[model samples]
Target: MAGIAIDGISMVYTLPGGGEVHALNDVSIDVDQGEIVSILGPSGCGKTTLLNIIAGFLSPTAGEVRMGGTRVEGPGAERGMVFQQGALFEWLTVARNVAFGPRMAGSPVAEATEKVERLLTTVGLQGFGDKPVYQLSGGMQQRVALARCLANDPDVILMDEPLGALDALTREKMQNLVLKLWKDTGKTILLITHSVEEALFLGERLIVMAPRPGRIEREFRLPFPEQALSQPAREVKAGPDFVATREEVLSMIWNMEEEIMGQAEADQG
Candidate 1:
């Protein structure tokens, strides 16, 4: 069954002078339960806008989103968001942060504590529970964010560039962790990423969006994610098919960017 359905979604913003900017145009996608999908697009392609609409943080100007046959009206406990920067409360310790969702939901004290502990361990922060979020490194903090999202036991997780801020080595390690968590939890995940390679590695199904008014440009079902699950990520990325696919995606996005730039120049001229 489809976990989330986005039908004919279009978003328009009214400018100060009453001009309108169309951010997304008739974008539609149905993500299956437990699927890992990644979105990639240029700067103005409305990737984040689409994600926010699905998360119920923003209402689209046209169309609607549904989860399990129910129209999404607003934020609910079943959908969790992990932002580019870890949005944890700085004053809260790692344990409290991870426990926030369950605690807010009125879970029994003992149950919430046990869940937090297990999640911390699952995210590799078992011993750092008592530390303030400020004390951790960038990568570790993101791990906490992932655990906090999982603590809610949400059916769908929306990640907006969750690994965008990490250093290269740390980002790679986090990528592996994300795949492991996806495999273990069987949760549906929709991740928005700027990096072509990251999108290729993390997405079982990869979506490329078009510019101007963002819409689905191309979709690819790749074997790399499954391959990376059992083999070293570096090796999987180095395989011939992976290299070929990466080049194809890169060229597609690069051409879109060039066209956008040329259009902007012409408008200015």
Candidate 2:
């Protein structure tokens, strides 16, 4: 029942030209136990950078990240990550790729088989396990990646635009699939995406981050556990509150993008 605590994470990177780039400043967010939190922002808004910090791939310049009670200094099995390109090994079959995590952890093949099969079913890839990773479409490959991450049985899942490359229809399908898996497995998930509609639909809690030194801009608690998945998405989206939140986030990003662009313009002027 452990969830991640991101306490005032701040990061600054020095460019080769000697200028400092402030990526995130005091970006504090928390995903409660079994909560699905979605973060949305424009490009260069440090959304992926924030995910990297949570995965322990990049250390914050200041502040701390903790799970349960222990601090995170580096990557661990408890934090599983999925990337934008699916990042699957082309040489491995779907089943083998899914088994990689458990095998590395020293779990016997027989014991791991059940988990693999269940995850494949969860992602709608149940019968494609024996296929080569290259044979699948982009959307299907991401599904395999989702299945692979679930096979590890990690405490928290961090995803960086995992469905961003798919076609519009496929992306919608994957969005629903993500909701299904989160509800079924009760995994603590922190997903970073640029789609405001997605953040509103898939997340039980919505976290909005501002750019030019990413920090918490806003947060909203969902009204119900199954509000997003209980009915037709089109119908649910027609509700006034969903539309209002969507517009609010859109305005936030619009302003942030303008500010970033204006800064660049002023420098040129």
Instruction: List residue ranges in candidate 1 displaced over 4 A.
Output: none
lDDT of 1 by residue, 102-200 (tens): 999899989999999999999999989899999999999999999999999999999999999999999999999999999999999999999999999
Clashing pairs in 2: none
Minimum summed lDDT over a 10-residue window in model 2 is located at 221-230
True lDDT of residue 75, candidate 1:
91
lDDT of 1: 0.94
Q: lDDT of each structure?
A: 0.94, 0.87
Candidate 2 TM-score versus the reference:
0.95
Residue 121, model 1, lDDT: 94
Tell me the TM-score of each prediction against the true structure. Answer: 0.98, 0.95
